[model samples]
Target: MKREKLNEMKMKFRALSSNEGFARIVTTAFIMPYSPTVEELADIKTAVSEAVTNAIVHGYRSNGDKYVSLTAVMYSDGSLTVSISDKGCGIPDIHKAMEPLFTTDAENERTGMGFSIMETFTDKLRVVSRVGEGTRVTMTKRLSVFSK
Candidate 1:
């Protein structure tokens, strides 16, 4: 298959509960045209929601003063790349965070499954973080003609 490069879309929103839904909606709207099925849309939206939720709940701790950034890029091969980041309490151990049912906050019934869900939904997942700095999660999926 020939690779085709497309433009990228980037947006940043405050790490607030209300903005989470907006982020998911905007992302879905932008990628929906290339998505093949409703299942794919749900998957993408859920993955994005998980990422944003993590940023708001874990990263900003519901402060709502911080900001979360999202970026989407279409590759030449019809692959979609998404990046969600927050400058908050960084993950101490990414491997452990990615593990299912491992959450630092359990009192809230977090389930610690956010990372796992994101991983399951997207074709690729990458996380970058510092102890006290912040975290960046990038996910990718191949967009096929049948995806729509």
Candidate 2:
């Protein structure tokens, strides 16, 4: 069955490392009424952090002038969908990029596990990108313990 969207939020911000935490905090606040379990909250926050960090660090390469957009939707079925996008250098190979420990920024000691962690924590993960354009990562999770 299709789930109706209960609420949504969209925000665009400079692709600064500091905004990663801001994104997570806003996301958490958005879902507070849902009463998600501690584990679920942690999972969502971690996944958001990874995606936002990737946009700032890898997508924009810390240039900070570019923008990253975050969109979140809450569904009637106790599910949340969050998408983070950046207008920066896109991934050349998404398949390889999603591979565990496969990082393009080894020089910066990046673990290359951002996608992996996001996948592990979310119920669904989708990534779209163009080589010279940008990348968008969307993740969803069902909040089984949420208050209806």
Candidate 3:
């Protein structure tokens, strides 16, 4: 489909585990205007939750002082892209991190499937991280007339 920008928004909030729910709710609201299907809404919410949780728990190490940012863009063809970012300790290996059950913090019972989960729910997933800098996870899902 030809891509044309329809709507977009960016938000930054404190990186606190408590804010994870807020992130999920905000993302749902952000895309609700498009009249997404129940499954699409659930998928988006879960993806947002996983990304935000990773930012607060793993990215900031639960510091509660740093911040996590989220951005959403809608294209004319019924596609949506969501970007979740954090400016905390960055990932050392993007590949290994994407592996299932590979948790950097094993003591916390992390499943190490955050990346995979996001990838499964979204049509496309891209992760960029730099040590001591931060991580940005962007996922795209198609939600347009043709999809219906």
Candidate 4:
């Protein structure tokens, strides 16, 4: 079903590990007016952090020179959708990559839980990628408004 978008925002930043926090903060600020609960906010932040970190570490292979783009949309039904895209080496096997404890960089002590964490935090998660091209991770969540 299609929902009317109340607001939208897009940003592009260098694919640096340090920028992961920046992305999370920006996403939180964007959704603040919707009055999400503390738990909801934390979940979104964690998913955003994982998505951005994946774009920086796996997509770009820690190449700070690469770029990642993030787009967020707020729907009238209190749902928010966030998409993160990276113009770097894409996932060759998305299914295998998303499996638990499946890390291509095990030598780096990577937990291989990024996708799992994102999936757990968001209501819906979709990933699109092409080898040697790029990858885009889209996540959506329905926010339960908090009242004080």
Candidate 5:
């Protein structure tokens, strides 16, 4: 079936802890209208937060000099796709990194559950990265709120 017109938005923010909250807020604002319920909005927001946190904490190694980019596109079929990306030290082993509770940093008490949480919240999750290049996380979900 043909999809509806897509609504798109893009943003770039410093890879800093403070921007994690901003990422969540921007993601929620972008996807809330398409979400079926407030719970879905919350889920997506948390997912985005995880993605941003990973970029700051892992990708950029808490280096505020780098930037994280976020993009959201809303499809006519009521599905929304959001992508969070950063140009920094890419994940060495995507499969290992995706493993639940497997963190590279034990000193920081990181659970290493960002990818896991993103997968659970959205209908689709994809990761594209290259060591020494960067990482991009894309998540898609069909929202019910826009049906009516």
Candidate 6:
């Protein structure tokens, strides 16, 4: 589906644990004007949380200085694309990392289902990572209109 883009907002913030909630709230508020369904809204929010959490807990994995950036764009087709990026240690094996029960920090109570959950909730989920560079998670979801 192709539609004209409406608006876009991108921001970079400190990769603090506290900012996870901030990501979710801003995502919800940003897409509110599109009148997304309750389910769609929840799905987007969950996806954002997982991506941001992964960057903070897995990507950086240390108490140091780093920034996580989030970019969101709204299309005329009622679809949104969100890209979450981190300049922390990148995943060595993206395929292995995306497995249902894979976690580098199991001792930290990580569920290891972040990627799977994101895929389930979004129309498309893509991850690109380099050993020394960083990782970027991009997701897109089409919001269906209410037909009541």
TM-score, ranked from best to worst: 2, 4, 3, 6, 5, 1
Q: Please, what are the lDDT tens digits per residue for candidate 3 over residues 1-148? A: 5788888989999988889999988889888888988998888899999999999998999998898999999888889999999998999989999998899888888888888889999999999999999999999999855365
For candidate 3, list the clashing residue pairs, or say none. Answer: none
Comparison by lDDT, 1 against 2, better one? 2
Instruction: For model 6, give the 10-residue run with minimal summed lDDT.
Output: 139-148
* lDDT of every predicted structure (CA atoms): 0.88, 0.94, 0.90, 0.93, 0.88, 0.92
* TM-score winner, 1 or 3: 3
TM-score of decoy 2:
0.96
lDDT of 2 by residue, 51-123 (tens): 9999999899998888999999999888899999998999999999999999988999999899999999999
Q: RMSD of model 6, in Å?
A: 1.8
Taking all chains together, each candidate's TM-score versus the true structure is: 0.92, 0.96, 0.95, 0.95, 0.94, 0.95
Candidate 4 residue pairs that clash: none
Q: Taking the tens digit of each residue's C-alpha lDDT, what string does model 1 give over 1-148?
A: 6666576899989888999899989888888767547777788889999999999999889888788999998876767888999999999889999899999889999999999999899899999999889999999977667344
Which one is best on lDDT?
2
Kindly list the per-residue Cα lDDT of model 6 for residues 17-97, writing each as its tens digit: 999999999999999998998999999999999999999888888544889999999988777999999998999999999
* Candidate 1 lDDT for residue 12: 88
Worst 10 residues of 4 by lDDT: 139-148
- Checking candidate 6 for backbone clashes, the offending pairs are 4-76
Question: For candidate 6, what is the TM-score?
Answer: 0.95
Q: What does the lDDT come to for candidate 4?
A: 0.93
Superposed Cα deviation of residue 99, candidate 1 (Å): 1.0
Model 1, poorest ten-residue lDDT window? 139-148
lDDT tens digits, residues 2-112, model 5? 997568999999987998888888877776665458778888888899889998999999999899999998998888888999998999899999999989987999988
Top-scoring candidate (TM-score): 2
